[model samples]
Target chain A: MGCVRRSERIVRLTRHLVDHPGTALSLTEMAEHYGVAKSSLSEDLAIIRSVFEQDGNGFLRTQLGANGGILFEVDVSTTREQEIMAEILAQLSDPQRILTGGYMFITDVLSQPQILRNVGKMFAKLFAKEEPDVILTVETKGIPLAVITSEYLNIPYVVARRDHNWSEGPSVSTNYVSSFDRRIQSMSLSRRSIVQGARVLILDDFMKAGGTIKGMIALMEEFSATVVGTGVFMATAEPSEKFISSYRSLVTLAHMDEMSGSVVVEPGNYFTERM
Target chain B: MGCVRRSERIVRLTRHLVDHPGTALSLTEMAEHYGVAKSSLSEDLAIIRSVFEQDGNGFLRTQLGANGGILFEVDVSTTREQEIMAEILAQLSDPQRILTGGYMFITDVLSQPQILRNVGKMFAKLFAKEEPDVILTVETKGIPLAVITSEYLNIPYVVARRDHNWSEGPSVSTNYVSSFDRRIQSMSLSRRSIVQGARVLILDDFMKAGGTIKGMIALMEEFSATVVGTGVFMATAEPSEKFISSYRSLVTLAHMDEMSGSVVVEPGNYFTERM
Candidate 1:
């Protein structure tokens, strides 16, 4: 390779740090890799560190000592994560996204990583005391957060499908009232999926009537599993007659009036009250 | 408050660090809060730093300058994040969780904080070059990831609902094949929701045939939105016919044989090849 300039060296070094995890590289090592002088490499690393910190991804880390080098840290904060989630929830709360079927468009919100991280952190912290053996949620909207939370807790998650498959030997079915559609729908889970007596943390994206959560709680009981705790991304505080009780919400939909262009949302009480 | 012990003081100090992001506290101040000596506090901080680093959450940063104190750097690596994601995929790939509907119980996997953090970083890195204006995905499974990615990119995400609501004016509808169900399903998006000519990134949880992806792409085109890139959490490499031509996958499902109790998955080529 031909000679690389100082700026190019900085970008390459930053990208390398991003690609590698935990391992730190010394100034001399980086200098040799880029065919640059140690002094020049030091300057380049300074610029790279500033840029990585500016990006909020936490990619470049510096250590001081004889064996010290540059390490990449991938951690992001709970609040920063929460800000992203609040934005998505804000979008989802838009009345325009609500369909006649009473379902809100959730794909955009669920697919994003920052929001998920914050939401997952919230779940992990809430359940930290419970120390559930597994996380549980009903398909398909609940799957994203449940999966992320399980990973954080270092536990497995099991999904309760809306319907049974031919491949599943046998399944237990239950009735759930749809909060959005306001209709009774059937939910099912394979008999062999969840381990009996496992402490399960139930999660969902949105809960209005709490029907699905109730159904899952019932199913867990049927499987001899304990419902340790319940969590939801968004919950409507209006509906008083919920199927499941004692659940935590990240954000609550306080009010929405499309005709008046009025919508109100606030961080749920869980943040302050939980700890 | 009564005098707190050294260990209690350390836990309280760490909690404070976790709560106050971007703010550093001096060792003297921390020691004063707990009524402990500066040297005792130093030892306590050392233990706190070790615990934080061991968790892979971040680091307890110390500075010796006049204005410097101790700060926590919540940094994680892309590789470590990816490793967590691979672990989640492995859990999701459990054959016992796959129901007859050809769906895996993945709700728990999506609800994790660390996984979401990694996912957000992945999208930020992927879209750093293009810097798309908005993220788009169809309802339900895709919402969590889309929300997380949008948060990292600091962009808004738009969800195309599967059906139209009365609040939304007129919606454009399209027919798409469901890869899991292997059936034709109708997908719809409100015309007023998306901005025309804006660059959009489409995201989803699983892609077998890419039919829904095509529908979203079409919906984007209808609004004159540009499809900058597409992404999915899991994609089946087989079934060559797909709705979208180019996309990135976090994990690839190579094969599934129920009778033989064989299911194989590996990290997607996207990680190894991309920056």
Candidate 2:
């Protein structure tokens, strides 16, 4: 087939693979669909898989056995996670999402389920060795991915609320400086929420100054729960001391030159280190 | 063995079975653990299985042939997803969570991974017939269960944000009156977020006036996507005319008498209805 025809076929196959995850299609089937030889289809798949891996979305797993074909598995690495996070931070850093008071429009970041799943999977892979008893996050945005990670690990999760909830038993409160507001706010968790002696993995959507993680660490300490690891979806590269040293981040925002509309995003260290 | 000894053996076996999900313990192994006869262990297992099934969690499927023993298979219908939802709604209706504001505290409701998993499993059963293409939810709280349900169904999900996101491209926005604040807010979705002809299932953590659901429906219409189903974790009975009709709820809050500290919660019709 011509180059143009091959490119079109690759795009069609990519869409099909994405649309039908876990199901593999044989080279013969692809060849039949494209009215091409099996050898031609193999070459096309090789090019498509290479492009897909380069794009950092996922990879195509090929099998040659009877009843085996090719399947697309979303194997996100720490570096890719960081790349995605940098992209997210770049989006957040955009003046459009920034409110007058310097608050980021986080509603978009919190709403996307696919992003949450990606982040959760990244965390699961990073902390797989930890074998945490549960995933924990503060109420609201972090709840989505915390729950997802917890599900991935087959563990329960608890959320810490910012305010005092009467329904919850006596809670342990700690002061944490909010990165968005730059003001110290009280974060609280019910004493009954965290299981004693349980290993907890803390996850958050965005961490600029790492104050929230600090407070969570304090709460976990109060409950005698060990903090197995910490994971964040995105972090800012500025204010070098803002992020804690031990934590893993999927993406780091290097900088965004608003004047030039130039946002630089790259894969983070976690992606490279984990996957 | 004496009756007390046999009872102790049964209790120990039951605990072991609960701890090891789906693993079948052979009679010889059980006898070795309890230092009892194989016949006695078999009898104890039979009794434990019967009691467990009576309690309605699941059954212990026992195979009598060689290399067979007792394996636990959870009975999906026995626990009655509706009963679980009612319990969750009752927990949410705590006056402590409501405080002075009419708005209920639901952040904790979204954080519980087990509850979210159960909710997802319930929705999977409810929408088993439809097999929705994507799970849809508005931002924040709804994202958790929506992610879980999407994972359960193995389908992609789209979230409608309250504001237009430039990164998401030109989004369609719909005005939704907030049930708690009574303020009209716009929920927007990128034009590219959802498939045009896909069947979408909308999910939310809580439904009071259902304004958000209505906005979601409008958003789906804009994309020319079919709204296959709508489900909520909890719904208030007070809201007679919600934003949409033909929606399903796991639990309905019938009443909460703050003065008496009495809360009335019941399973919604969605639990028993066919998908």
Candidate 3:
């Protein structure tokens, strides 16, 4: 390979780290790939790290161990996170998104790459130290959020299903009461979806009463997996008594008035979790 | 508010384009944001574009008009895509992934961020010219694939539900025959999920007979939307006569010996589409 300039190498390195978030890259390999000296590579990485931190994009972690080299950890600053939450709050407060039930239609926000990326970064940041082996979520709406969070964390995610299909083969099933209607429901996860003793972080787009999250925890238990932490994009505040008390939410739905068509939303525990 | 180095500008520019794929960026705003001259910004963009294309990460598009600017178009090369497909094929070929009813348990692969990102980039590349207004898919398995595709395309996606919930407000419903069991089933999308005359690309994790994609198309028509294209991560080769003739798939399951626990998989129309 031809020798590349520092500017070109930095751009490519930045792209590489961004693409493979939370993945460690060896200096020896990168140096050989770029046909540059190890010292030069280290200096270049330092510059990249400085820019990433100054821009508030993320942190470039370097471990001195033999297996460690460089890892990009996504970090969304509290101020920027608050700004994103405020924007989401405004979107949720739209009257048209109000349904007959207390549900706020946020499919639009969850589907937007820009919004989801930021939200995922926030979740990844909150659980950065958790070093989860995998991410977990129930099927349907939470898929996107879970995917994005795992993407940022550089881990795979597993989805538990409400309906058991014969195509999935043998599976473990668990029953949990629906917090919304207090009805008993069952969710299943394929035996192969998760390995034994894996640490998992639970993520969801919306949480009304935490029934689904509770079910995910129960399902994780079947795999002998440890629940490292839980995060949600939004949660209803009406149910002061949640099935699971230990969880973080990006936004809180304080009040929803169907007759008058009004809604109240505030930044969730995500803001206070750090404190 | 101060002068910035070319290396610094390029790093930030690359991160910006990669983060907001397929979204056009105004050079004026970017230049102002970077505190650089328009000429300098153009030069920086040119360098970034060359490196991106060389790395086979994506393409940086430049438009020159009142509403013109640079746009990042994610493009995974045939060679890179083949490597990704081969990796996925190996994973799927495992007998452990085989389940009853001839279904390959792919929740792990679809939930994998690295693999899903590549698959999503491939879909975005195949339909790059389609300029889909939105991406669509049925809930459960396909949600992650659809979300990743839309993320690469920098657009929002909608999920159709197998069953409707009052929390979604008004929705449009359609019934289609299941290609696997040849059974009739109903799927619905929120009324606001899609708008009139929108261009949509359907995405899914696996396609047996493409009944789900067909149902999605029918639902899109109710909203007066056009189905520009459809893509799937994997599709079975059985039932040679597919319900939909115009679609793309990454991997094809040519055969499966359930008793012997052997399987055959190869690149799908995704390879032939370019030809």
CA displacement after TM-score superposition, residue B122 of candidate 2 (Å): 1.7
- Please provide, for model 1 over A157-273, each residue's C-alpha lDDT reduced to its tens digit, 9 standing for 90 to 100: 767767664544577888877766677788777676677788988998888878778888878878898888999888877786677758888777777665555556667656656
- Give me the runs in candidate 2 sitting further than 4 Å from their true place: A1-122, A128-134, A138-141, A159-200, A208-228, A236-240, A251-267, A271-275, B1-110, B163-171, B195-198, B222-224
lDDT of 2 by residue, B1-275 (tens): 26445544543455345423345678777678668788877666666555556545446777577768876543345356656666686676666764344445566666655566667767765774576788889876677778777654556677777776544556788887878778989988866567789999999977888888888988888889999999998888987877677788887878876566666677776756654
Q: What is the interface RMSD of candidate 2, in Å?
A: 19.8
lDDT of 1 by residue, B92-199 (tens): 678776544454555446655456556765765666557588888786667667766665565667666665544345778777777666687877776755777899
Assign candidate 2 its CAPRI class.
incorrect
The CAPRI quality class of candidate 3 comes to medium
lDDT by residue (B1-275, candidate 3, tens digit) is 12237767777888888888877899889888878799988877887888989878889887688878899999887689879988998888888777767777777777778998988888888897987999988887888888788888888988888888676878899999877778899998889888899999898888987787888888888999999988888888887878887888889999888799988888898888662
Give all candidates' CA lDDT scores: 0.67, 0.68, 0.85
lDDT of 3 by residue, A15-93 (tens): 9898889888999999999898999888778878888899888999986777788989998776787788888888888
Q: How close is candidate 3 to the true structure, as a TM-score?
A: 0.96
Question: In order, what DockQ does each candidate have?
Answer: 0.10, 0.09, 0.68
Best DockQ goes to which candidate?
A: 3
- Fnat values, candidates in order: 0.15, 0.20, 0.79
Residues A1-275 of candidate 2 have per-residue lDDT tens digits of 26435444544455446433445688777788679998877776676566556545456777578868997654465466556576565655555553333334454555454555566656765786686877889865677768777755556778787887664566898888876667888888877667789999999876778988988888888889999898877666766786355787767666656455545444455656543
Off by over 4 Å in 1: A1-124, A139-159, A165-170, A179-182, A191-193, A233-241, A249-275, B1-124, B139-159, B164-170, B179-182, B190-193, B241-243, B250-275
